[model samples]
Target: MTGTTPTAWQQRIDTLLHALADARRDAAAAQAREVALLAEAVEIAQAMAQDAGGPTSVADIPMRSLAAQIGAAARVSDRTVQKHMSDAVVLVERFPATFATWAAGDISRGHVRVVVDAGVGIDDNAARAVFEDAALEVARRETPGRLKPAARLLATRLHLVPLQERHTAAATKREVWVRDLDDGMAELIAILPAAIAHGIRDRLDQYARRVIDARDTTDTRPTDARRISEVRADVFADLLLTGHASPDVSNDAIPADEAIIARVQVTVPALTAVGADDTPAELIGKGPIDTATALRLAGTATGWDRVLTHPVTGTVLAIDRYRPSDHLKRTLRVRDEHCRFPGCRIPTYRSDIDHTTAREHDGPTELTNLAHLCRRHHTLKHHSAWRVRQTPDGILHWTSPTGRHYPEHPARTLVFTTEQAGADIQTGAVSESATASDPPPS
Candidate 1:
């Protein structure tokens, strides 16, 4: 029935995996065993502390020796061991439902960690139960990152504190720091407001994508071959050191302050924008953000599009251009919020609006035929063996060079990238660095 045959090593590995199915099923029970055992160890250690002395907290220490001993045996840092002990105890004691599901091996340690971290702040029994139920439902079907929005939403709903007040207080702590590393590497860290941070990254991504798109599509003898991640890093360093991305790549030396005029796709619920509720607005490739920030951004936006979605399933149904632009271009941007390629999150502002079927081959310029593709994927589609087709429903089904199919759905959103406010942010102050870094190579 089948012409293909597996190699010996592949067959052996497959057989081994299948044979261990029952062992995998017992993982939940094993987790229970470990958590119970470790929890008991914590209890005993506490008891020993009491016997050795009064006021169980000794020299302002708590369970350090026991954790250190466990760490030594487990070959991990004592802090890690102690954290594990605490998580295990918390899972069994504070989050019984989460522990039960995790013990059943339905969700992984990552999911458990996200749930615990999100719900730890909740003390009210009724609110905690509500959050756990909502969070667990999301945890079942999504990755830890995806689950964060629902977790945060539920946690926020439970909190009595108004989001606006909390946001104001947290906004005071923004700062930047740097740490030198090995191999001529250094970590530049900034604790910025979420929107600003995400916008900065989005700009970097867009800038890098443009260079990559040019490299792949250009007719000239292209010399630059850096990957997007490498390009982003280089751009970051060059911009900081010279107030511009390296001109060597694309002569993209627009000053960083000028370049700070970045556009980002933000999906704000209708009610959330008007301050009706605090359901978080989302940056498409990014996660949920506080609604106050969303309102502030939306208030001063140059223009925006109103997208209507299916009320029940959240499927985008229609898009209405709020600002005057080519309707087709705006439609494609909202529908293909990011690249149509599977797993590529490059946004539309920096990607090509591509024809799924080539115009040269009698493919018409129509909804069913057009899709957004980042430059890299566009190049791959035309120059490489990879193939893609779009359905009338706007799903881009891609067949890879190796014959695997991945279907990328149109972004399920009600609104996306707006003409951002603060476009006049100036790089004039940072322009002095242009003389510090050497000129772009000839």
Candidate 2:
């Protein structure tokens, strides 16, 4: 205050600026809370709808429909209502009994959506069981409003599966065609798990290797029963392995086993401060890369960081790398929860890490430099004018070079209203058509 006396007008301008900042901050917080509330309401409504089956009763009105009603009453789109409703589902899924206990206030729609999505893909009965148990536990231990994390924790414990990738360099047990199955008529062999099949294939490959080794080592002239069995297994395995390679054998063939998804976090240069809390900053995103490609990225040190045209803002800022921090990775995962491409729902868990800024241009390895793109979109990004931008709130906004922009809806942000297209609400529906009428319902 003593640095220099401001002119009267200057002091008024400074006060006005402070007031504006306070207003903006309050408005953002309010919007977030509103979204959270709408989400919770949707969840309760969805739970009732699921129980009643197709909203036949007053209590059974579908969450989306209920949201639509709310939207209509409030002069908003049913989609917005459903979005809030989905948030409700997330909340209920997180804190199952919150709908009844905190039904009047506190809990918001976003919390519900988080829970609902966390519970999705799990069988319904199983999900319900998990939800009820988690909800009760949360109610007893935590305050009424803190149910979201509790529900997520419960679901993770109940429904999460291990994501370990097992490697096998050896050949597995395989099928060898026997021309003289003439001794027996038509028969089907038993089906087996991949591990079992792999073991068999490996054993067969070993036998073949032995046969070759033996033949090459000396002038061997042996034709024994054991040898014959080994030979048969080897032949079967080879045939199974290379059936497609030789059309004369059969069109059917078993492809070599390869890991479908791989996750590895490497320490790379950090680019930006995420927030005031977390230090040792991190960034996270995913993409589809072949095993070889993934290992190559794994090998890199500095990684990538650079600025490019932000699809939304049009302003440029340094993009960060998606590297060794769980929080950063989680943010990217949620943003790109699936590939950052329109009409694609391939979840981030199965995607590869992509650079929004081309690496050749000296982009640093960072989260801003990365995005979760499935194999298809990862390739498409290189092939087309598709651009992806991650908003500060963690939404991925995608734009085609043609100027059409689309928001890649996160599963956590989904609303299950009749307003969504088809029965697959995950595919999403519209509150109203963008330009005019709806797309005639695919």
Top candidate, metric lDDT: 1
lDDT of 2 by residue, 154-261 (tens): 343344341111111212333434243565754336443333443354444434444545554555433322444556454564556774123222112222341112
Model 2 Cα shift for residue 131 (angstroms): 19
Backbone clashes counted, model 2? 63
Error of 1 at 285 (Å): 4.4
Residue 190 miss distance in model 1 (angstroms): 0.9
Q: How well does candidate 2 score on lDDT at residue 340? A: 59
For model 1, residues 63-117, the per-residue Cα lDDT tens digits are 7888898889989999988877887788778888888887787776778888888
RMSD of 1: 10.4
What does the lDDT read for residue 35 in candidate 2?
Answer: 50
Sequence-dependent TM-score of model 2 = 0.26
Clash counts per candidate, in order, are: 1, 63
